[model samples]
Target: MKPLDDQQQACRDWFEGLRTRICDEFEAIEREAGSGASFEFIPWERTDEDGTPGGGGVRGQMAGKIFEKVGVNVSTVGGRFSEEFAASIPGAEDDPSFFATGISLVAHMANPHVPAVHMNTRFLCTTKRWFGGGADLNPPIPYADDTADFHAAMRAACDAHDPEHYPRFSKWADDYFYIPHRKVHRGVGGIFYDHLDSEGEAWDANFAFTRDVGRAFLDIFPAIVRRRMAMPFTDADKARQLEWRGRYAEFNLVYDRGTLFGLKTGGNIDAILMSLPPVATWA
Candidate 1:
């Protein structure tokens, strides 16, 4: 594995910082809910095919009064992609060597009334570099208000970058987050975009947009959580949430690109699977 350059290091640092901020905010919520729970950070290492040090990351997780299971992970890793997989990734067509740094979080609320959510943003470099990711809402008991607010936050983030972004990416999310076999949308869409390749002087521009996406999430999601976390839920609601979680598990295991990327790159198994809910039921 090659050493990360200045730009790569900057991305790594920013992702780690975001991870800390997210975990802190989540822990605060747990405290506010009168739970003493806090994030437990688990460190993991990664290595290249030759068994040389590649990179590693910490997975921060907590189960408490508010959040049933939440995972915020940040990793920076570099190595060559498998030949078969290399063909699918942009720029890796010619050379499979790559570097990636990112933060990924998924929260499954204890209260069925509270919506679960997923957010991730990553910077990857092969022969080229680009940024990708977005956030989406997953409410088993759908709430129009929460869906609108989540999309609104995402829209504001996109507008700051480019007016065209929201529409383009919202459609992308709708398209990407669907489960064809189940014939159901994963959740009310927010935004999902990729291959925002740095086209000469676009790195800073893209990075700024990515940062705003993270900030938008930080600003919006917790408020939504707090709003619904304390709402009363019955056994039926809990059952619905578990069934929805089953769909979530299917999507992650079968189709999530992040999961595939982590697995292919020799990522930490526990961290990669940390997105799975603590319990899920199929109906």
Candidate 2:
């Protein structure tokens, strides 16, 4: 309703800053693997349905020897939601206006041995405001140690905020990232959370928790990538990855809330769809 508050502006800035840090780290990983691949950031504008100008974002993408394809995006957009969508978003039943800012990332590893990954964190306002997002590891060739370490990092991030956070959010991820038709869970679940209301003084604590999640992803995922990046894989391994990718694609296109939000808000098409893998096989 009023001009963006100090806290709201801070959230937007933080998301943008996180995007830069992540892109830099990923590029460094590319270099370590003897690939010169670097992210190319493309900027786009958002326009509201009634022709008012909304904020925009940059989409960062790279393909390299280790990472087959990766996309990192930071977006800050505000405008009215459509009547159909407004009813579903909390606090938007009466006022269709909304504000959202966050960072989202998805990486598809070139080597099948190196697991693919996804992570995101966001803050949204619609009369009511809240924070949400998470990370997960998806490996075609599952490694027990890799899964354990990934979950441990996420649990540490959660435990720092609240003792109940790890168990609650971890289960939330398992439930949220499921493929009903195939009766399979998507990846080795990490953490998924949403609708964490930031009321009054509670905003600071919630924001801090969200930041820790991002920090955990930054610190842990690259370590995992480097661990298996050099491992050799056979033709069968590659085939399994391709098949798994098809399932990943299905979830993003059909069940992902972020994808729907971006499309509804006039966000960049390529950036919104960046979660989809570069290549996949149905069978």
Report the C-alpha lDDT of model 1 over 21-123, residue by residue, as the tens digit: 8889999888898999999989988989888888888888888989999999999888888899999999999899999999999999999999999999999
lDDT (CA) per prediction: 0.93, 0.93
Scored against the true structure, residue 107 in model 2 reaches a CA lDDT of 97
Per-model TM against the reference: 0.98, 0.98
Q: Distance from true position, residue 262, model 1, in Å? A: 0.7
Least accurate 10 contiguous residues by lDDT in model 1: 1-10
The true-structure Cα RMSD of candidate 2 reads 1.1
Error of 1 at 82 (Å): 1.4
Residues 25-65 of candidate 2 have per-residue lDDT tens digits of 98999999888999999998888888888888899999998
lDDT of 2: 0.93
